[model samples]
Target: MKIVFLIAAMMATGLIDSAVAAPKSSKQRCEIVKKKIRDIESRMRAGYSASQGIRLEQRLRELKKDRYRYCR
Candidate 1:
């Protein structure tokens, strides 16, 4: 009961916002993917723990695949 109430309150306050606003244009979508790829690459260059590295590498591959789809 308390947990449910807390979750509702958090969502109402936007503290746990999970909405994913996809880009409305192909150009914008491609740009977003490129930006995300850049960000993840930067984080990798900055260094990460083994588990985090694995996750980031996997995400990078997914982003690259999407980049091909969106950019061309």
Candidate 2:
């Protein structure tokens, strides 16, 4: 039980750490953002359910914001 809890805590913190980590270079970051934008656009074209479309649109907006901030 104690070991399981310890592992769970470590996994939780690891996820937080990875999520907070940034790309090593601006070019790489911009490329990643661009690729994500393309992927999202393709998925949008392929068609999603209404709820999934809303979520993807929100994420695309956030990615576009990041691209504006970093890619330009």
Candidate 3:
């Protein structure tokens, strides 16, 4: 009886943990991507090198695409 109760308690705790540990939803992902894009754009405006600017631009484009895909 005690072992059964212990197992039940462990299972209940596991379920609670899983409920609390939710992954980022699509809206959350979009928000994060937008923030990163804004930061990168600000850096680009602040006189970044050509190559670094190009990389950041590419990343920004990809993030925009992701926003369209995920946010839709």
Candidate 4:
């Protein structure tokens, strides 16, 4: 009962905002993927461990795949 009241109060006060998102345009998706790749590259250059770099590269590949699927 207390938890329910607390949650209701929080929502009324706008302490927890709902996530309302619009679909991304192709350009926006491409830019986001490019930014993520650049971030991974920068982190690699900044001395991320080999394993961490590899994982980032894997994530980059996945992002690229998403870009190809959705942006192109």
Among these predicted structures, which one has the highest TM-score?
Answer: 1
Clashing pairs in 4: none
Q: Can you write out model 2's per-residue Cα lDDT over 1-72, one digit (the tens) per residue?
A: 997885685345331123456889878888978877887888789897998688778878988997998798
Angstrom error of the Cα, residue 43, model 4: value is 0.6
| Residues 1-72 of candidate 4: C-alpha lDDT, one tens digit per residue | 998996785455333334656446878767766666666666667786777567667876887796787667
Q: What lDDT, from 0 to 1, does candidate 3 have? A: 0.65
Model 1 misplaced regions, further than 4 Å = 1-18
- How much lDDT does candidate 4 score? 0.65
Rank candidates by lDDT, best first.
1, 2, 3, 4
Q: Report lDDT (Cα) of residue 60, candidate 2.
A: 85
Per-candidate TM equals: 0.72, 0.69, 0.62, 0.56
Better of 2 and 4 by lDDT: 2
Worst 10 residues of 1 by lDDT: 9-18
In order, the Cα lDDT scores of the candidates are 0.77, 0.74, 0.65, 0.65
Q: Least lDDT summed over 10 consecutive residues: which range in candidate 4?
A: 9-18
Summing lDDT over every window of 10 consecutive residues in candidate 2, give the lowest-scoring window.
10-19
Clashes of 2: 0
Total clashes in model 1, counting residue pairs 3 or more apart in sequence or in different chains:
0
